[model samples]
Target: MKELDKIDFRILKILQQNARIPMTELAEKVGLSSTPVTERVCRLEREHYISGYHAHLNPHLLGKPPLVFVELKLQSKSGNISKISKRSAENSANYGVPSGVGRIRLPD
Candidate 1:
C-alpha cells in the first residue's frame, strides 16, 4: 500500500465514523472534489484497506436477545483443535450471527 497523506487520513477518519456517508458529503468534509474522493475510496478498497461496508444491527432487534461469549477448549492438539475451530467459525459465518465467534490463544 502507498503511504497515506493528510487528506487520505482525513477521508479514512470520516468514513470510519460513517461508511454510509455519501461521497459528495465526504468530499466536502475532506475538502476534495467528489470525483477525487470517489476515486480515493475505490483505490483504498482495491488495496484491501477497506475490506467491505456493513450496517451495525442490534441483536435484540433481530430476535436473538442478549448474547454471551463462550470459551472453548479441545482435548487434542494434533490438528483436531484447528479442525474444530474451523467448523465453529464456518457455522457462525453461515448462520450470520452478529459478533460471530473467533478463536483466541491463551498464554501459558
Candidate 2:
C-alpha cells in the first residue's frame, strides 16, 4: 500500500464534508482537472480510503422527532435501581416529562 499525499488527504476531507459534491467542483477545490481527480477518487475507493457515500438527513425528515436518550449503569442489580426508577417516575409525573433536580426546568 502507498502513502496518501496532501492532495489525496484534501480530497478525502472534502468528500467527508460533502459526499455528493460534483466531480468538477471537487477537482477545482483540490487544484486538479476532473480526469485526474476522478482517477484519484477511484484509487481512494480501491484502496478503501473512501468507503461509501451516504445521504445526510435530519431526524424530522425521517419522521422521528428528536427526544432525549438516557443510559443508566449500576454497580449491582439491586433494589436501589428500582428505587431510583420510581423516584424518577414520581418526579416526571409531578413536574413534567423530564424533570429532575439539577436538570432542565419545566415551563410554568
Candidate 3:
C-alpha cells in the first residue's frame, strides 16, 4: 500500500463521511479543482483503498429485527467436523453460527 499524504487522508475522511458528496463540492471543500479531486478518488479506488460503495438500510424498516448471538458445541476436531458444522449452521433456520466449541472428558 502507498503511504497516504495529508491530502489523501482528508479525501478519505470526507468520502467516508459522505460517499455521495459531489466531486465539485468535495473539490471546493478540499481547496482543489474538480479534475484533481476526481483523479484522486479514482486512484483511491484503483489502489483498492476504496473497496465498494453501499447504502445503509434499517433492518426494522424491512420487517427484520436485530439478531442475537447463540452458543454452540461440536463433537470432533477434524477438517470434516468444520465442514459439517458449517453445513449444519447454514441449514438451520436460526442465525447461522459457523463454528462451535468442543469439550473432552478424560478417564480418571
Candidate 4:
C-alpha cells in the first residue's frame, strides 16, 4: 500500500466537508493543480480511505415532516406489533409499532 502524504490528507478533509466541490476548486484549496488532485483523490479511493459521501440535510428547512425511523432485525413478526402500534397511535407520542422497525412521526 502507498503511504498517504499531506496532499492526500488535505484532499480527504476537503472532500469530507463538501464532497460535491469541483475538482479545480479542491485542487486550488490544497495548493495543487487539478491533475494531481484528481490522481490523489482516485488513489485515496482505491486505498479505501474514502468509502462514500452523503449529504447532511436539514429536514425542517427542506419542509419535511419530523419522522423518525428505528431499525431492528426481528426473529419473527408478531401480532403484538399491531397491538402496540394501534395503542401508540391512539395514546402516546410514539405514533406507531415495530414491524421489524417502526415509522414514528413526531407530533408538531
User: What are the TM-scores, per candidate, against the unseen true structure?
Assistant: 0.62, 0.64, 0.64, 0.56
Q: Mind giving the per-residue lDDT tens digits that candidate 3 earns over 21-102?
A: 9999999989999999999999999998899889998766776665444546555665577676665555445443445433
- For candidate 1, list the clashing residue pairs, or say none: none
lDDT of 1 by residue, 1-108 (tens): 788889988988899999999999999998889999999999889988888889888765665544444445445545666666566766543332223344432222
Tens-place lDDT per residue, model 4, 2-28, is 998888888899898899999999999
The lDDT of model 4 is 0.76
Q: How many residue pairs in model 2 have overlapping backbones?
A: 0
- Put down candidate 2 lDDT per residue, 1-108, tens digits, no spaces: 679999999999999999999999999999999999999999999999988988767766566655444444555556586676665676443333222332322322
The TM-score, computed over Cα atoms with residue i paired to residue i, of candidate 3 is 0.64
How high is the CA lDDT of each candidate model? 0.74, 0.75, 0.75, 0.76
| TM-score winner between candidates 1 and 4 | 1
Which of 3 and 4 is ahead in TM-score?
3
Q: Which stretches of candidate 3 lie over 4 Å from their true place?
A: 68-108
The worst-scoring run of ten residues by lDDT in candidate 4 lies at 91-100
Runs with alpha carbons beyond 4 Å of true place in candidate 2: 67-71, 75-80, 83-108
Candidate structures ordered by lDDT, highest first: 4, 3, 2, 1
Candidate 2 structure lDDT: 0.75
Q: Judged by lDDT against the true structure, how good is candidate 1? A: 0.74
Clashing pairs in 4: none
Off by over 4 Å in 1: 70-108
